[model samples]
Target chain A: MLDVEGLAKATGAGGKEKIKIQRQITLPWVEAVRISVRNVTIRLGRTMITASGIVLGIAFLSSVWTSGVIQDGLQQARFEQERELVAATTRDQAKPDGGKTEDSAAVPGEEKQAQNSKRIWLVVMSLLVCGVGITNAMLMSVTERFREIGTMKCLGALDSFIVRLFLIEAIALGVLGSVLGTLLGHLAMLGIFALRERSLSVAAKMDWGQMLTYLLLCILIGTVLSLVSAIAPAVRAARMRPAVALQTEI
Target chain B: MAKIECPECGEQIETTGIVTVCPKCGADLREVMEAVGHERDERMKTIVRDDSVTTHEFIVRTRDLKKIYVMGEIEVPALRDVDLDVRRGEYLSIMGPSGSGKSTLFNMIGGLDKPTAGRCFIEEVDMAQLDAFELAWLRCRKIGYIFQTFNLIPVMTAMENITLPMIFAGMSTDEMMDRGRELLDMVGLGDRLDHKPYELSGGQQQRVAVARALANSPAIVLADEPTGNLDLHTGKEIIDLLKELNQASGVTVISATHDLKMIDVSDRVVHIRDGEIERIEHRADIDLEVGGMGEE
Candidate 1:
C-alpha cells in the first residue's frame, strides 16, 4: 500500500511539504444494517420481547380497521335485502315499512360514528404504551452493553455509528411486530364476521384494495414509531464516555 | 460572584463576571484561566489538526498535565503537573500505588479524558485540540487499547469482534474478513473464530481482545492492567504475547500496571507515587526487589 502522507503531499500545492488528508468515519449504510440484523438474531428472545409491545398496539389498530370494513359491507348488504323484501310485499302490506326502514338506518349510522370515536381513543392509548415499552427496552439494551459500547468507542466508532446501530435494531423490531399484527388482526376479524353473519359473501364484497393500503399504512406507522422511540436511547449510548467502560461491570 | 486575594501586589479583588486582570498589579490571569479550560475566546473552539502545534520525536508526550475533581466545596487533585515522554517502539510500564494517578495518566495519553490544566500529544498532534469525533478518528487509526475487563462485544463472534474496527476504517467486507482471519491466526485463535465471548475462556477472550485492538494496525497499543484478572500462567502468556508483538511489529506498547512481571518485558519502567513520577529505570538497571505496586 502507498503511504497516505506521501499521497497527501503529492496532492499539495507545488507537490511538496503539505500533507492534508484526514480519515473520515465512512461506515456504510448496508454494513450497519447487516450488523443490526445479526445483533437482532443473536438476541432474538429479547428482540421478540421488545417487539411484542409493537405487536399489541398494531393489532388493536388493524382490528378496528378490519371491523370498520366489515360493518360497512354488512350494513349495505342488509339494507339492500330489506328494501327488496319490502318492495315484494308492498302491494299487499301497509306502507308504514317505508318510515321504519328510514329510522333503523339513521339510528345505526349515528351509533357507528360513536363507536368509531371510542376505537380511535383506544388506538391512541395503546400506541402511547408501546412507545414507552420500546424506549424502556432500548434503554436497557444500552446500559447492559456498557463494556461493549466502551470497546467500540476505544476501537474508534463515531457517535453517529453507535446511534445508527440502535435505531436499526428498534426499527427491525417495529417492522416484525407490525407485519405479524396486521395478519393476526385481519384473520381474527374475518373469523368473527364469518361466525356471526354466516355470510362469507359479504366478506367477499369487501374492498381488497383498501385492506392492502391499510396494511402498508400500518407498516409505515410501525417503522416511524420505532425510530422515534429509539432516538433517546441511541443518543445516550453514543454519549457514554469511553472511560466508563473500563471501570464498569467487569 | 467570587472574591479572591490576588497573589501579586497583595490586592483584594471582588468580581462579578470573568476577571482576567488584577487591579493593583495588572497581573494577567488569562493564562491561568486558559489552563483551567475557562477561556471565553476562539481558542475554546479551535481544534489543532496539524502535528506541528506540539513538539515531536516521542510518540506520546504530556506537559504539566493536571486533573482535579470537584465535589461541592471539596477539590481532589488526581494528577499534579505530570511531565512524561514515551519514545517510539519502546515497551514502557507505569507502576504506581492506588490513587497515584496511574490510570489518569494512562487515559490522558490514550486521549480518553480532559485535563484541568495541561496538554497531551500523540504523534505530535495536540490531544487537547481535537473534539470528541476527531479524537475518535485519531484513536481508531493510531492507538489500540486493551482493557483489564476483556471487553469484547458479547454477542459477536471472535472474528466479528476482530473485524469491527476495520468496518469503521472503510474497508470492504472482503478485506475485513481477510484481515480478521489473519489477525485471529496471529493471535492463535484461528480455530475459535466462530466462538462468542461467553464461549471462550478468560485467556482466549483476552486474545480476541488483542486481535481486535490490532485490527487497524495502529501505531501504539495501550494496555490498562492486562493481567489484572488472569491466573499466573494465563497472565504470563498474555504478557509474553504483548512482548512478542512489541518486538515483532515495532508498535509502541504502554501498560499501566502494578504487575512487577511486566517489568521483565518492558524496555523502561517508570515508578510514580503521590501523583508524581518517583523514578525511571531501564530494564537493565531496575532494582528487581520490588513486587507489583498499585491498585488501579
Candidate 2:
C-alpha cells in the first residue's frame, strides 16, 4: 500500500499545475455515429416500426413511378402502332382522312392526363403519411429517452451530440427503409406485369435504367422526409435542461 | 517503524507510509487515512491561500443561490439564498428530507442547473459566465455524477457503460478500455465486464455507475442518494467503495444523502430543512453514534 495521503501532500502544491497540463479531449464524429447505431440496435423494434412506415410509403411511390414509366412506354408503342394504322387507313382514304387522324391522337392524350393526375395523388398521399409517421415515432423516441438524454448531458455530451445522434439514427433508418421499399416496389411491378401478360417474360420489357432512377428518387425522398421529421424532436431533446430531463419518468 | 491502531478492529498494526488495510482484522484503513489526509490538505490550502493573497481555498462556492420553479400559475421556491463552500479533496455530505432542496443544491454545484439569482463557482470559474459549450467542456473534464438509480444505459455492458464518458471525452479506444478495466477492477467487478445492467444486481449496477463516473478522472464526484436503491448491507458496501475511491484518488466527493452510513464517513455534514441550511457539522465536533453535535 503506497502512502496515498503522503503522495497527495507531497504533490498538492503542484497538482494545479499538473491539471493544467492534462490534454483536453474532444469526441470524434465517428464515435457519435457508433453510439447512434448502438442506440438503434437496442431499440430495434421501435426503429423498425418507424422504418416500416417509410418502407410502405416509398414502396407506393416507387411502384407508381415504375408503373407510370412502363405504362408510358407501352402507350408510346401503342401510339406508334396506331399512327401506322392511321397512316395506312389515310393512304387508303387519301382523298378524305385528316379529321380522323386528329381524333385518334387527342383521345390518348386525354387518357394520359387522367392517369398522370391519379399517380400524382398517390405519390402525394404516401409522402404525407410517411412524414406524419416519422414525426410521431421520433417524438416518442425523444420522450422515451429523456433520462438517457439527461445522463448523456451530465456526462458532458454537447447539444450537438444529441442532435447528431437522433439524426444519424433517422438517416440509417431512412436508407434501410428506402432500399427495402425499392425492392418491394420492383417485386410489385413484376407481379402486376405477370398478371397482365399471363407470363413472367413481360418483366423483360421493363427498362432497368428507368427502374433504377425511380428507386434512387424514392431513396432520396425517404432520406429527406426522415431528416425533416427528426429535426423537431432532435432540437427539442437538445434544448432540454438536464435537471428537468433527469426528473422525467419513462 | 511506525504503528497505528485500526479504526474498525482497534488492533495495533505496523505501518509504512499509507496503510490500505489492517493486518490484524483485514479491515480497510483507507477511509481513516483519507480523513487524516483531508484535514492536512485543508490546512495546506489555507496556508497557500493566505500566502498567495489570491485564489479562493474553496473548490466550489455558492453565493446567495436561489432557484424558483414556476409551474403554470404556481411558483415553487426550491432554494432560498443558500451560501456554501466545499474544500478540495473533502468528503462533504448534504442531508435533508424529501423536498428539502438538497438535490437542487447538488445540481447547482454540479453545473447541471442554473440558479435564478445567485452565482456558483466551480474550481474558481463562475458557471454563469460559461457558454453552453464551455459548460459542457467543464462538465466533461471536471465533474462526475452518480445517481440513486445508477443511470447506466440498460443496453450496454458494464465495460461499455464505464467507457462511455471516456468516449465522449474523445479518449482513444485502447486508452478508454485500459482505464475502463482499471475502474471496473477498482470497483470489484473485474469479471463482470460483459454483463449488462439488467443482468447485474442492484449493488453491482451501482458499482458500474461508480466506475462510469470516475472514467474521466473528474475533479469532483457528485452523488445524489447513490445507495438509495440498495439494501442496507449493499448500501454500506457502496459507501465503503466510494470512501475508498475518495481516499485513493484524492477526488472531492460531495453527496446528497440521507443514509447514516454515508454521513458517517463525510468530513462535514450540511443539514437542510425548508430549502434553507439548518447547520453544518464538522466530523470532529459530531458524535457518530448519536448523529448530533453541540452548538459551536
Candidate 3:
C-alpha cells in the first residue's frame, strides 16, 4: 500500500502535491445494485425469458405436491365417513373392534408410497433440467454483455461488482418468478381436483397451513436453484479480462 | 533563435549554422553565437536522474517492458524491451500495422495490461506494484480511455456515460451532474446528453466517449485508433477536437493509430514493428503533414 505522496516523493517527483492516491476504491454497493436493477429493467425481455425456466420448474413441482395433498384430504374424508358408519351400525359389538381410532391416522400402503416417490422423482428431474436451462440462458447473457462488462471494468468496476450484478439479477427474477409459479401451480391443481370430484368438501378437509408451507418451500427451491445455476456464469463474466471488451468490439 | 550582432559596428546579422563572418561588418560571429546559441533547455536536455523517473520528468516511462502470450505451448511475443518515455502535456502517437504489438504496448501503458518483464511507471507509480483495486483507482483518476469503436454503454444515455466514471471516483450526484454537463459541453454534445449511443451517429458517439474520458480530469488519455472508423472529414474533426482538448487542459494523450491525420496533431510518433521500437520521430522531424507521406 504505497500512498501517493510517499510514492511520488520516493520517485523524485517535484509535483507530489498535485495528486492524491488511495489503494482501494469501489462503487458503493447501493449504487451497484441500482445500476443492476436498471440494467434488468432495460432488458426485461431477456430477463423474463430467463426467469420462465424457474417459473415452469417450480410450477410443476408445486403442482405435484399440492395434488397429493388434495388427494390425501379427499381420502381422509372418505375414511372418516366409513368409520363413523361402521361404529354406528355396531355400537355394542366389542366396542367397535377397538382399533379404528389408531387406524384412522395410519398412512396408506407401500404401493401409494412408491407412486408418490416416482412422482417426486419426475419433478426433481424437471427442476434439474430447468437449472440447466437457466445456466445456459445466463451464459448467453454474459457473452452478449461482454462489451458492457468490459466498459464497466474499465470504469473501475471490480470483479466482485461484476459478480454482484449478475447475482442481484438472478435473485430478483428468481423470487418473482418462483412466487408466481407456486400460486399458479397450487390453484391449477386445486381447480382440476375440484372438477373431477364435483365437490368442495375436500377444500374444507385440507390443512391450509400445511399447503402454505409446501408453497413456500417450492418458492425457496426455485430461488436457490436459480442462484446456484447463476454462479458459474456470473463467475465467468467476472473473470473476463477487460481487454476482451475492446477486442470483441464491432 | 539568437540574433548575433557585430561588436564593432553593432550591425545585426543572420548567423545561423556556420556563418563565421558577418556579411555587413566583416567580423567573426562564431564567439557570439557559441555563447547564446548552444544552450539546451529542459525540452532538449537528456537528463537522467539516477535510475528512477518522476512524474514531473516524464508522465509515463517504460523500461525494457515485455509481454509474451502463451497459447498452448506456443510463445507469442507481443512486446519486447520497449523503452519509451512520454512527457507531460505531450501528444504521442503509436503507429504499427496489424499484429505489430502497438495495441499491446498501449494497453501496458494504460495499465489495462501487465508486462511480463520490467516496469511501466505512470505518474511516478510503478503499475506492477498496484493491486487490482489500486490499479483501478489509478485508471479512474489518472488514465482515461477512448476506444476506436466508441465503447459507450448502449443502455446508458450520453449524460450517464459521462457520469459513469465520476460515480466510480465517488463524487456526489450533484458534483457528478455538474462535471458531466461541463465535459459533455466541452465535447460539443451539450444538447445531446439525453441521447443513447444508438440514437447518435458514429462521430457523436465518439464525442460522448471523449466526454466520458474527461469526466475525471485524468492526467493522461489513451485513445486507440479513435478515428479509425470515421470518415476522413469526421476523423479529422475528431483529431482536431483531441488536439484542442490536449492544448487546453495539458493532458498527456497517447494514441495507437494508423490514421496519418493523427500525425499532424502529435508531438511525437512512435513506430513499433515486430515487438520492438522500430524508430521514434519527433514532430520536428516528420515531413508529412496532413494527407500523405513522403515526396511531397
Best by DockQ: 2
Fraction of native Cα-Cα interface contacts (under 8 Å, chains A and B) also present in model 2: 0.47
Candidate 3, residue B113: Cα displacement in angstroms equals 1.6
Q: Residue A131's C-alpha lDDT in candidate 1?
A: 67
Best by TM-score: 2
Q: Write the per-residue lDDT of candidate 3 for residues B207-285, one digit (tens) a residue.
A: 8888788777777889999998899877876887677667655778999998999987898899999989999887767
Estimate the TM-score of every prediction.
Answer: 0.79, 0.82, 0.80
Instruction: Mark the 10 consecutive residues where model 2 chain A has the least summed lDDT.
Output: A1-10
Candidate achieving higher DockQ, 2 or 3: 2
- The per-model DockQ list reads 0.22, 0.26, 0.22
Top of the candidates by lDDT: 2
**lDDT score, candidate 3:** 0.77
C-alpha lDDT of all candidate models, in order: 0.75, 0.79, 0.77
In candidate 3 chain B, what residue range of length 10 has the lowest lDDT sum?
B42-51
Can you tell me the CAPRI class of model 1?
Answer: incorrect
Model 1 misplaced stretches (Cα beyond 4 Å): A1-21, A91-97, A192-207, A245-250, B1-56, B70-75, B287-296
Candidate 3: true interface contacts recovered = 0.52
In the range A86-106, model 2's lDDT, one tens digit per residue, is 898878877667788899899
Q: After superposition, which runs of candidate 3 have C-alpha atoms over 4 Å from their true positions?
A: A1-20, A91-112, A198-205, A245-250, B1-55, B287-296
Q: Interface root-mean-square deviation for each candidate? A: 7.3, 7.7, 5.0
